[model samples]
Structure formats: C-alpha cells, structure tokens
Target: MVTLGQLTKKVEFLEKRVKQIMKMLQMVPIVAPWEWES
Candidate 1:
C-alpha cells in the first residue's frame, strides 16, 4: 500500500535522476556526433 506521499517522493527522485541522465546523454552527442555522420 503505497501512500500518495511515498509515490510523490519516488517520482521526484526518478525525475531528478532522469534529468541527470539527460545531461550526461547530451555529452555523448556533443562529443561524437560526427562518429555517426558517415
């Protein structure tokens, strides 16, 4: 039985992690977009 508060906290934590991952994801493209240009 997950409470609303607990669900909210989990969602927030996941959102934060996703944002961090997105920032990291951007680096790969910026660093090597040319790798796939061929």
Candidate 2:
C-alpha cells in the first residue's frame, strides 16, 4: 500500500537526481561521430 505522499517524494528525488546528471553531462565535451571516423 503505497501512499500518495511517499510516491510524490520519490518522484521529486528522482527529478533532482536527473537534473544533477544533466548538469554533469553538460560540463563534458561531446565529440561528433564524424570526427571519430576520420
């Protein structure tokens, strides 16, 4: 029996984690596939 409040908390936590991961990803440089083929 999961309560709505607990579910909401879990979702909020996951959203925060996702935001952190996105920020970290942005800090890294992304190389194009064409560059690798050269």
Candidate 3:
C-alpha cells in the first residue's frame, strides 16, 4: 500500500521536473506554429 507521505513526495518531484522543463522551453524560440502540418 502506498502511504500519503510517499504520494506527496512523488507529486513534489513531478512538479519540480515540470517547472524545469517549462524553464527550458521558455528559452527556445518559436519559429513556426504550423510547420509540422506539411
């Protein structure tokens, strides 16, 4: 059985990773919005 503490820790880790990825994405430039449609 998973304890509440374990679930909280997992959620925190995921939130941290998402924040890091968001920061990296912000540094990238958007050259095309629909380039993949072709």
Candidate 4:
C-alpha cells in the first residue's frame, strides 16, 4: 500500500532529478536535426 507522504516524496525526488537533467542538457551543445541539414 503506497501512502500519500511516500508518493509526495517520490514526486519531489523525480522533480529534482529532472531539474538536474535539464541543467546538464543546457551545459551540452546539442544540435537540432534541422541545423544538421543546414
């Protein structure tokens, strides 16, 4: 049985992980497919 508190904690953890991933992506120079064609 999953509790509300546990679910909230898991959501918060996932949000933090997503933010970290976004930061990492910003640091990298990722080119778009359209740019590649140009």
Q: Top lDDT: which candidate number?
A: 4
* Candidate 2: residue pairs that collide: none
User: Can you tell me which runs of candidate 3 are displaced by over 4 Å?
Assistant: 31-33, 36-38
Candidate 4 — which residues are off by over 4 angstroms?
A: 34-38
How do all the candidates rank in terms of TM-score, highest first? Answer: 4, 3, 2, 1
RMSD of each: 3.3, 1.9, 2.3, 1.3
Per-residue lDDT tens digits of candidate 3, residues 1-38? Answer: 99999999999999999999999988997558688677
Residue-wise C-alpha lDDT for candidate 2, range 1-38, written one tens digit per residue: 99999999999999999999999989998788889887
Across 1-38, the per-residue lDDT of candidate 1 in tens digits comes to: 99999999999999999999999988875656677777
TM-score each candidate.
0.73, 0.76, 0.77, 0.80
| Better candidate number, 1 or 3, judged by lDDT | 3
For model 1, the superposed segments whose C-alpha errors exceed 4 Å read 30-38
Quote model 3's TM-score.
Answer: 0.77
TM-score of model 1 (CA atoms): 0.73
Q: Give the C-alpha miss distance for residue 5 in model 2, angstroms.
A: 0.2
Q: Model 4, residue 17: displacement in angstroms?
A: 0.2
For model 2, the local distance difference test gives 0.95
lDDT of 4 by residue, 1-38 (tens): 99999999999999999999999999999999889988
Clashing pairs in 3: none
